[model samples]
Target: MKIKKAFRRVGMFSLFVAAFLVTITSISNVSFADVRDWVDYEPMRITNTVTNTVTESKFRQSSLEKKELNYLEQKKMYISSDEIEGPKTLEEAANINQYPKSQVVATGYTAGVESTGKSPGHPEYGITYSGVQVKRDLYSTIAADLDVYPIGTILFIPDYGYGVVADKGSAITGNKIDLFFNTVEDVYAQWGKKELDVHLIELGDGTLTEKELKQLNETDSLQVFRQQITES
Candidate 1:
C-alpha cells in the first residue's frame, strides 16, 4: 500500500512541473510577437517622416522660383516705349536740338594704340589730347574736335548708343569723331570711317534748368535719357 502511495505523489509532481514549463513558454512567445510587430512598424513610420520632409522642401523651392519669375516680368513692363522707337514729333526734334553746336553728322575713328607716350588723362598710352580720361566702354567715350563738340558734351548716336566727349584728336577735327578702343585689333575690326547721326544731349557744364528738367521728366521719349543723366 505505501509503494502505491509514493508512485501517485511522484506522478502529481511531474504533471505540475510540465504545466509550469508550458506557462513559461507561452509568456515568452507573447513577448517575442510584440517585439516583432514593433520592429516591422518602426521602418514604415521612419519612411513616412522622410517622405513628408522631402515634400515640404520641394513645395518651398517651387514657391521661390515662381516669386522670382513674377519679379522679372514686372521689371520688363517698366521698359519705356521710346527705347523701342526713335524721336517722333517736331517738338521732340526741337527739344533734342538744345545743344545745336554740339550735334553733327560725323565719321568715327579709334584711338588707344595710336597714342604716344604720357597722354594727359590716360598716362598709360597718352592717347587723349583733352587731358580727360577716356572710359573703357566701347560706346561711352569719344574723342572730338573741341571747337565742334566741347569737353563734357554728351552725344547720342543712332547705331552706336550714347557717349561723352572726353578727349580730342588732331585728325578728329571738323565733323569727325574718334571712338576709343582698348585694343588696336578691336579698333580696326569694329569701326572705321562710317557716317554717324550724332545728337548733342548736353553741352559744356551740362546743367539742367528747373523748367528743362520738368519738361524732360514729363516726356516719355526722354525717360531713359533723364534716368541716365540723373544717375550719373
Candidate 2:
C-alpha cells in the first residue's frame, strides 16, 4: 500500500511538470508571432529637385477705413475691403532677371510663384515662372503625408509642380500636402491642389562621387541617395 501511494504521487508530479512546461512554450510562441512583423524595416533616402520663381505685382487700394459703417449696419462696424482693379506694385510685372530682396509671407509653410492671367491684357491666362518677384516671403511645407518619411524633413523646392518637405507644418500633419500657387487662377486651374503619392530618392550616400552632385546641379535637377552596396 505504501509503495502504491508513493507511485501515485510521483505520477501526478510528473504530469504537472509537463503541463507547466507546455504552457510556457505556448506563451513564448505567441509572443514571437506577435512581433514577427516588426523586424528589419530599413530606412530609405530620397531627394527631388524643384525649380521655383516668384512674381510680385501691386494691387489697388479701396477708399475704405477700418471701423467704418456699412450700408445697412445700425451701428459703427469694422470694415475691410479687397484692393482690386490694379496691380500690387508699380514696378515691372515680370522681373525674372533681377534679384531683389523678397518679402516674407508665411514662414514654416510652402509657397510658389505663378501667373494670374488677370494682367490687363489677358484676363484669363497664366503660367508658373522659374523666377519672379513677390511682396511676401514664400514658405515650403512638409509634414506626415508620405508613409516613408517623418515630419520636419527639410526639402528644397524650386518652382511649380515640384516640392519636398524642407520643414513640416501643423496643418500638414498627415498624408496631406499643401502646394503654393502664385495666383488664384492657377489655384483654380486644377480645381484646387490634388493629392498624389510620390517616390523620394535618397541623397547623401558616400558612394556617390562629388562629380555626381555637380552634374545634377548643372542639369538643374536635384540628387537623391541610395543605400551602400557591399563590394564582395
Clashes of each: 1, 38
Q: How close is candidate 1 to the true structure, as a TM-score?
A: 0.40
Model 2: per-residue lDDT, tens digit, 1-232?
A: 9999999999999999989866755654433323342343222333333535343322211111122322444886655554343323212221322422222122122133232323534422221122212111122223333342343232232232123232233444444544543445544653255433333323222122224323433342121111110110
lDDT of each: 0.54, 0.33
Each prediction's TM-score against the native? 0.40, 0.24
Output the TM-score of candidate 2: 0.24
By how many angstroms RMSD does model 2 differ from the true structure?
A: 36.7
